[model samples]
Structure formats: C-alpha cells, structure tokens
Target: MGSAGVRLGRLKANTSALFVCDIQEKFRGLIHGMPAVVDTASRLVRSAEVLEIPVFVTEQYPKALGNTVAELALPPKALVFEKTKFSMCTSDVDKAFRKMNLDGIGQVLLCGIETHVCVLQTVLDLVEKHNVEVHVCVDGVSSQRETDRSVALRRLQGLPNVFLCTSEMAMFQLAGDSKHPKFKQISALAKEKRPDQLSAL
Candidate 1:
C-alpha cells in the first residue's frame, strides 16, 4: 500500500475550483457574526480569484434572500447557481461543476454563511455524492447561534477528506509559491480594510 510516489492530495494547486455557498444578502445578516464572516469570506474569494481558480457560487433562493452579499466581489461571469435545497448537488450547481471540469480538480475549497445548514449540507453532498475533496475556511462560515456553529464544524471535522482551514490557510494553499506572480497583491489584499481594496485584488 505504501508505494513510493507523490501523493496527489498533498500537491498544491491540484485543483482550481472554489464553491462559495449561501452567503446571501438576507441570510448572512441573520448569522451570528456577520461582519467577521463577510470579511473572511471576501478574503477567501479574492485569494481564489487571484490564483485563477474557477469560482462557483450559490444563493439559496436568491429571489427570497435577494442576492449574495456585495463584499464577495464576484467576477463578471462567475458561475452562480441558485437553489432551493441546501445541498448544492441538487440544483444547477452540479451542472456548473461539470462545466468547470471537476475530474482534475482534486480539491474544492468552500466558504459561506450559516455553517450549520447550507454550508454543512453542501460540503457533505460534495464529498459523499461527488467525491470532491473539501477544504472549509472556518472563519468564513457562521451560524445563527454559536452552539450550532460549533456543532456544524464538529460534524464536518469527522469527514476523512475535509480540512477545516482558516482564511490564511486557504490563501497560502492557493498561493502555491512565494514566487507566484500575484503574491504581493494577494498579501496586500490580506491586509485590506477599505471597500476599494476589493477591486484591486
């Protein structure tokens, strides 16, 4: 079983896909810690985009929740799929994933609001149903209650392929190397506090 070969799972930039789940306008404001979630999620999106990762976004019934929060800085043509079910698999999300060509994408990075409901369900579905390796940014997800948030993370931590990462962790993983062309801009984005910083990254 221990063949001497490079483990693909340990390779960086092996996947260029990101799934930002249910950080909708109405829903995110109701989460326990809106500001922190928004800040971290924004940063995660920026890092992913800077690394040229294909972004997949979800809005659980955007007609009802309005739309994803403005802080995300969505690309002009990001794959944004709306769904009624909490699991992104059940909706056009899967189709979007197909379009993104997931076969070579060994990892899927996840960030969003309501850690217990949409984010948790989506992560499980992506792993169990689609077999996508998952990386969750802990600071980017939240719940309406601290207890529920803690419980959700506990549940996700049990998954064999799921890594509970921080915003900084996700950023560096995508960075690949200090020599990556966007390193400086990405570093500056990490310290950005003003709204205008969104466009620069």
Candidate 2:
C-alpha cells in the first residue's frame, strides 16, 4: 500500500477480465437489492463476451448453494468453477488467473453478493497477493444488510490498486473510444436503466 501499490492504469480491453463471484440461486431472495445486482452483473458479462475479455465465474459450494442464477446465461468461453472457499482465489481460480496474467491480464472486474465477505476477501488477495489492479462493480454487489454492503464498499475504496465503480462505467472504460470495433455493442449496454439509476424506495 506504499508507492508500489498505486495502479491507476486504464482498463485496457486485452489486459482485463471480469470475475463474477457467487451470484448463485440460493441468494435470490435473501440478498439485498438482488435484482439490481444481477442486472449489473449481466450487463458486464454481455459486454465482456462481445469484447472478448476473459470471464471467470465462481459458485460457492454449489452442491448446497445451487448454481449461478438462471438469468446469467454465460458465454460458451466463460470459465465456471465450484468453490467451497469464500475467496474465489482458490487454487484452481488463482492458477488460471495467474496464467491469464502471463498473457497480459492486469486488471480484474469483480461483481457478486456478500460484499463484505467473499467480495472483500477476493479484493484483498488480488491486490496484496496477486498484485492485480481490481475494480469492484458497486451496483453489482450486495449483502443481506445495507450497512454491511456500504461499509465494505467504503473500505474497498480506501485500498490501493482497488477501486469501486458501476458496471456501465466499466464497460465504457474497457471500450475506451467510440471508434472501437465493439463500440456499438458496448453503447447498447449503456442505454438500459442501470441499477445505479434505481430510485429511492
């Protein structure tokens, strides 16, 4: 978290990946703002597919927790894994992630439930252990309680090499310019009413 920690690099398409953590079926009715969170994650997944960025999905103890929700129709190229640990940095995931690193992956986007738990732990490991710059989808992660989610987000914002951002914002950043070949698809993603736009209840 010293001079070595500042990773303010732009999210280059070729060097970026999206990590969708445990948005499983079991969390459907229990997590706060579940619908909006799913909506955000879906947008990123769709965008990543069009951009050809790698996508990694983790299902927390799927045997008991169930698989990723049906709404998220993953791309054929996505890497999906079952995990019993809170942090998706399990041996398999970490190995694959590191392999991607050797191929130019430098930044990772994180989106899923239990912001303070799995999401938080994953962020710490990515930055501290793997030295990867990470961006968390603020509107794509939730917890059973608002306080927990809010506090976790604030804590994440304070870390070096870790940033909090909305899914739409991230899509555009990865695309970089309107002249990008995938601009049309990325632009379409922005037209929808994103979770961040939801009104006060």
Instruction: For candidate 2, give the lDDT of residue 73.
Output: 89
Candidate 1: residue 133 lDDT (0-100): 73
- Encode model 1's per-residue lDDT on 33-136: one tens digit a residue: 77777787788777777777788888888887889889788986678887889876765777767655556775788888778888888888887777767888
Angstrom error of the Cα, residue 190, model 2: value is 1.2
Query: Judged by lDDT against the true structure, how good is candidate 2?
Result: 0.88
**Clash number for model 2?**
0
Task: Estimate the Cα RMSD of every predicted model relative to the unseen true structure.
Answer: 4.9, 2.7
> What TM-score against the true fold does each predicted structure earn?
0.86, 0.93
Query: CA lDDT of each candidate?
Result: 0.74, 0.88
The residue pairs found clashing in candidate 1 are: none
By TM-score, the best candidate is 2
Clashing residue pairs in candidate 2 (N, C-alpha, C atoms within 3 angstroms): none
